[model samples]
Target: MQRFAITHAALFTVDPQDRVIPDGTVLVEDGRIVAVGPAESIEIPADTVVIDSGGKRAVLPGLVDAHSHSSLMRGVTENMPLMEWLPYYQLEHRALTEEDAYHSARLCYLEALKGGTTCVMDMFRFMDRCADAAGELGLRVNLAPYVADQPGKDFFSTREENKRLIRTHHGSQSGRIQVWMGLEHLFYCSEDAYRDAVRCQQDYGVRIHTHACEQREEEDAVLKHFGRRSIGMLDHYGLLGEKTLLAHCVWLDDDEIKRLADTGTSIAHCPISNAKLASGVARTPDMLAAGINLGLGTDGPVCNNSLDLFEEMKFASLIQKATRLDARALPADQVLRMATIGGAKALGLDGEIGSIEIGKKADLVMLDLGAPNLTPHEVTHAGGNLLWNLVFAARGSNVTHVWVDGRCLIEEGRSTQVDEGHVVATAQTCGLSLYERCRALDHLRVDMI
Candidate 1:
């Protein structure tokens, strides 16, 4: 059996009450946490491999990124209208081979692990290859192929492609990979496609994920096509439920919010992607008040330029405060919950991965609080809340080490599963090849990177 232990760190359990143990120890064996408590209380087991934290690190439940796309589109999709951005950005994805998809997923997992994210829900194409790459890299992932039936936007081979993907790869890799049904969007999918998606979920017992109310033109097109608002149409078509995870939900009124709440649908709020696409501010404060489950997301690498949940955390709070003209719009604790527990709940993995509870999988991140920006955060006894520092000050760079499934995938700022230089160089080479093959140089805000 395998064994691991980390001691002498500030443990933010992020449990129900947001418990923080200043001098804590966590013991693991065979991929499960055996004990977690104040350091003096928990005995170190024999033959355990101990990880040193230098007494100034904070041990947190690994950050959960609820929505992402494994794409090489960073810096190329900026400053375009949402409608224009889709074809310019996503269409070129068709040019990638299975090898390209593997490299893309590898790079995405590499960046996410470095940024302290242990779990991700990504929707894209070539999902089998992506699943294999994630399995090899040791990050827990939920993947699906983008399914749509629009005249020019069929991202999957057939309407039943996600079904095939689920049968072949879902729940594979010792449960590290879970597959879901991904609809491109309500606007892009026909009524038959939507019905089929619901049927697929019922048959396979997998969750349904898709975009909704994201683009500025999306609501108008949805109304024109379906004779109702976006959320209303989802409700009418029997698509709203606890098993549904919607990506954007940026444009919702009171009734639509009620519809979502009534159906128990979860939302993945992408603050950076909304701003980058000019998709406008979501009714986030209202959504939270309505008792909806909202989680933070980075969308895609090209759109946000980074898969840093720390960046998403800051924006998730700051945007709400600014949009509502209330300095108290979203408090520090609530935003922190959105990044951790909220994401777990959204992805329906809460029982196993969200908090630093004993009997849970050992997915954790250790951040060096001694870092410059995280300084003045010595201790809560000194009147500083590191929880707030985590939201407003911490960056992805502060992550010193990461553990997923009790395995050390990122150690001291480097990936253990991949050669960092080779991964970066390969992604760079693939990006250029994709651009050239897709003839995508015309869709740029800057002439050059």
Candidate 2:
């Protein structure tokens, strides 16, 4: 077993009690945390490699992006709502080759690692290639193939493809890559597709991920088609459960919120995407109060434009406060929890990887505080101010190192497994090609509109 020791750093466990241990030391053995406590208290074994944090960096559990679409369509669908955005994104997605999908996955993982995100639940096309890219890059990924069984040629994967991906990639990459049942929308899928999706979940014993109540049009469409709201429609179809990670609940009503809480469903609240697309803010604060498990997500590259959870955290807090007109709406500590432990709970990986506890997976990230943005650091409230500075001001550039499963995937802000230059170039080429296709489609749509 490989033994490593990270010493002399401030630790933010983000546990239920939110423990912050200054002058901390963490011991890792065989990709699991063996001990976490003050430096003077934890014993150092003889063969352990020591990484001296020098008390200048804050060590925290790595962030989890509960929802993401690893597409090459960043900045392509700006100023469009969900209905228009969906078709536009579909046009872009239909142009993605297997190589393009791989590049997009690489780009997503690189951006995620740089932003202190160690794990991501990615819903996208060409999921096998996405899983391959993630496996090569050493990132923990839950790959969900976008499933849409509608009659449109723009729709990519069918229920058949979704099941095939699950059977082939359920536990691929030595258990690092997990496959889940994905749906483009509740409306896009036929009743048979929904039944098969449910079976897919049971057959693979994996979770179901899909967009829900993202916009008013989605709610109206669900009501028009099924004579019920999205949440209620899902419940009526027997789709509500603990294993479901609904992407957006922005248009849910009070009863919908109650239904979500009662059914033990998890939510991936994409504040950045919701705000960007003019989709009303999800009642995250209300959902949390109603006992719904809420986690922060960056939605998709086309909508959110990036997979940076740090920006999501800040936006999650600020958007709620601004909408609610209360400065204490979503506090810094709460937002931090949403990024780490809350996300883990949503994904049902809370006990395994959320916090820095003994016997847990050592998925960790280090943030450098020596920069000018974090000046005047004082432990007045045992790093409360530090947490504030990190969530409110810090960016991906402040992330120094990232470790997943006790293995260092990123060191000195660089991915160890892949060439960053090559990955960026490939993604850029794919993005440009997709953009041109989208532009052509837009011109064709102008006549129809």
What RMSD, rounded to one decimal, does every model reach?
3.2, 2.0
Residues 1-449, candidate 1, lDDT per residue (tens digit)?
99888998888888887778888899988888999988889899788898767678998899999999998767866688687677676555557677778888888989999999999999888889898889778999999688878765644445667789999998898888999988877756788887888898999899888888886587888788678878887777789999999999988988889879888999999998898889988888799899889988999797889999999999988988898889998888788888888998999998889899989999999998999899878555222478789889999999989998899988899988878999899989997787776675344322100
TM-score of 2: 0.96
- Cα TM-score per model: 0.95, 0.96
- The true-versus-predicted C-alpha distance at residue 343 of model 1, in Å, is 0.8
Candidate 1 ranges beyond 4 A from true positions:
155-157, 381-383, 440-449
For residue 230, model 2's alpha carbon misses the true position, in angstroms, by: 0.4
Model 2 segments beyond 4 Å from truth?
440-449
The true-versus-predicted C-alpha distance at residue 352 of model 2, in Å, is: 1.4
Pull out the clashing pairs in model 1. Answer: 73-302, 74-302
lDDT of each: 0.84, 0.84
- Tens digits of per-residue lDDT, candidate 2, 42-68, equal 999999999998879889899999999
Please report the candidate that would top lDDT against the real structure.
1
Candidate 1: C-alpha lDDT: 0.84
State residue 54's C-alpha deviation in candidate 1, in Å. 3.6
